[model samples]
Target: MKRFLSLALCASMLVASASAVSAKTYKMKIHSTGNERNQSTPPLRQFAKTVEEKTNGDVKVTIHFNGVLGGDRQATEGMQLGTIECGITTTSTLGTFDPRFNVFDLPFLFKDYETAYKAMDGELGDMLEKACLDQGLRILAWGVNGFRSISNSRKPIDVPADLGGLKIRCMENQLHVSTFKALGANPTPMSFSELYTALSQGTVDGQDNPPILTFSAKFYEVQKYYSLTRHVFSVAPLVMSENFFQRLPKEYQDVVLAAGKQYEADVRAATENLEAETIAELEKTSMKVNSINDENHKLFVEATAPIYEEAEKLVGKDIVDVARSCLNN
Candidate 1:
């Protein structure tokens, strides 16, 4: 018995030593369209720092901000093809890869940050992450794109009717288009890169985005009204190429995954903190900001309620049911 125990201990030590000695150095890039001043950028930088420190320099991480590599879709495709190591992309972009992600595009699915986090960190996120893995992408952590609001040059949107006849630039997603149509706005699906020019030239009357984006992207420079619609809550996930993630040593994989969770916490906190500050900054600019009152908020909610049925069909009843359950809890 003593000899058997001694052999087991020896084997464990040998394996641990071998793992330490055989650690491989890996260099990886994390791509994001957000620039240096974007609210999520600093947390992402810290995420890279933590990854490098935890791995004892065995893993080197470099971040390419401002879409140096490509837009969200391009970067996502690159990762899926194993040409890009990692990236952070909106669920809308991921929706194209897997239609289940379109669930996020549903209007008013999340009414607040806490509810949003609970759903994404719970079964809704787990199921979506698993579905994405089957498509060659692995979701490390789900983060926020903040709740989207409408900003138009025309007027303050106190109610659904206020958006009537406005040409709102929306993401190239069917649900978004359908939602805008329901709200009585003309949903012009356009590339984000052309938004500034379009808004400047009045090609589109306005656009809906998170307040931080309206400030960071300087959309306020062209538009006059900013309403706290908080219409749709968007999520961005830090994703890695499944192939690259699998290629890592188990210990390094653990480090990277932990770093991803840290990134989620850091970025989410940063977003929550920056939101009020971003709004204050917007208020200081030429933009007029307003919030939808409880009565008006209800009106907005009721206006888009029909989208839920469409959402169920688009992403399956189970996903929509689970997401609604998360919010109710």
Candidate 2:
């Protein structure tokens, strides 16, 4: 019995030593279109720093900001094909890969940040993440671009009726296109990478995004009116190449996954602070900023409620029903 125990301990030590010797450096590249200093850099910097510290430099994450890797869809496809290791892309872009992601493009699914977090971190996020994995992309963690609001070069949107006949640049996703069309706006589908040039060149008169993104992207320079329509809560997910993730040593996998979750929280906190700061800063700029009151919000809701039913056709009826239950419950 003593000899048997001694042999088992020797085997364990040998395996541990082998594992330590086998640890190899992995270079992971994560890309996004956010501003390097303002929007995209912080969480990625935190992630890279934490991962390297935890693994003692066994893994290094290279973050490419401002679409240097590619536009949202291109970067996502790069990761899916394993040419890149990871990407942080908007939910609208995810919808192009799988229609189920259209759920996030639904108008006014969440009323506040607290409710949005509850739904995303819970069952709704699970459902969407499963769809992503099934489609051959592994979601590391869900993040956000803050609540989207309307901005126009023409006029302030105090009500839904103000959107009529306006040409707006929206994501190329069908759901967003249909949502804007339903509200009587002429929605022009365009990539976010081209948004600034398009606005500057008069290709589109208006767009919508969080205040932070509006300021960071300098949309306020081209847009004269910033209306707090707060129409849709945008979702951005940190995703990794499933093949790359599965190929990692188990220890590295744990470290990488934990870093994704940690920096998700970090980015969320940073977004909250930046949203307020950007609003104040935009007020200082030559931009007219306005907010939607309860009556206007209700009007926007009434005009767009049919989108929920239309979304059922895009993703499925059952998941949309489940989403409604989760949000209400």
What's the true lDDT of residue 47 in model 2? 85
TM-score of 1: 0.92
Candidate 2 global TM-score = 0.90
Question: Residue by residue across 29-116, what tens digits does model 2's lDDT show?
Answer: 9887876656546887888898889888877778788789988889989988999998898788888888888888888788888888
Per-model TM against the reference = 0.92, 0.90
Tens digits of per-residue lDDT for model 1 on 12-54?
Answer: 9999998977676788889999988887898899889998998
In the order shown, what is each candidate's alpha-carbon RMSD? 5.2, 4.4
Which candidate number would show the highest TM-score if scored against the true structure? 1
Clashes of each: 0, 0
